[model samples]
Target: MSIVKIVEQALKDGYLTSAMEAEVGRICNAASELSIEEYMALDRLMGALLTGEVVVLPRKQFINVMEELVLAEAIAKVAEIEATSEQNLDVGDIAAYALNRLPPLYATTEEGANFQRARAKEELQEFISKQVKEAIAQSLNKPEFFPERQALGTSSKEEVISQVSNLLQAYAPEFEPQNDQGTSSS
Candidate 1:
């Protein structure tokens, strides 16, 4: 949807969802220059946001406690290994590998998170350690097939903007800029 449509929806709903925010950011980044209408819509959105008429929802409302457990295990092991030898393991890779193999423990509240953490410690501590060890071993042995490959879910705003711009250009081949007269320019 266009920026104007998204703004209208947010106004009607009294909330700006993360997806809507991302979409607006994508559209704004994709366009070479904002039209008057688009600018006006953005202004309205800004005003509404400032006035608390449209609330912006957080990107994530829950946490996966398992990720924390795995990361802690991985970091400890990596630190120990790095301390002894010249080998510097990627803690992120180890944590990600272990996390993928383990079940997620999602919690929306602190109490729930503490409960899950305690449960995992009681039941899955050994398993979590084993997974982290296996992940470290695999990471050590795995060849750097794509050393240049960037990690997922870690894109900066500039990178996201560029990606959105590229996607728009690739997908919307027929899209044209609107001239000041409100007519599409060839």
Candidate 2:
């Protein structure tokens, strides 16, 4: 007989007394409560991880399969949220954020030096780009007339504005090559 049938027969034969049934229910309830607590802890941990508030050791330094499992669970949560939510969600961004926060899983000899270097490079590029854009805007917003602008045949404010727009579009294609105003390019 199947396990389910055997269990049914035992229960029907009064093998599982009222006390035993009550105890089983209590145990199941306790287990359900414990599982809820475990899930909550995991959710908090994953949020901390994705938000860069927590760190996990790399596989080389500390081989903890639980870390991987937690990450997997976090990813699964994001995926579930994305699938169910009406609004669009960026699962890739969540994955990237979690991965960036976690230590290097494959290469441990370098101690995440390469990852740090890449992030630094990206930050530096962003900073420099911001500075350059701000400088351009400030220069263009000046009231004073510029001989250089005149020489470039863009002495008029309209010409300067157009040039700025063009430069912005080239620097950031998300600005839309055709749209001069700040609006959704998509």
Q: Estimate the TM-score of every prediction.
A: 0.67, 0.19
Score candidate 2 by TM-score against the native.
0.19
RMSD values for the candidates in order, in angstroms, are 17.9, 24.5
Looking at model 2, the pairs that clash are none
lDDT of 1 by residue, 91-121 (tens): 6678878999999999877678778877987
What TM-score quantifies how close candidate 1 is to the native fold? 0.67
Whole-model lDDT values for every prediction: 0.81, 0.41
Distance (Å) between predicted and true CA of 117, model 1? 1.1
lDDT of 2 by residue, 35-93 (tens): 55445544554565566554443333322222232233343454465577653332233
Which residue ranges in model 1 land beyond 4 Å of their true spot? 11-15, 26-33, 43-60, 147-186
Q: After best superposition, candidate 1 residue 23: deviation in angstroms? A: 2.7
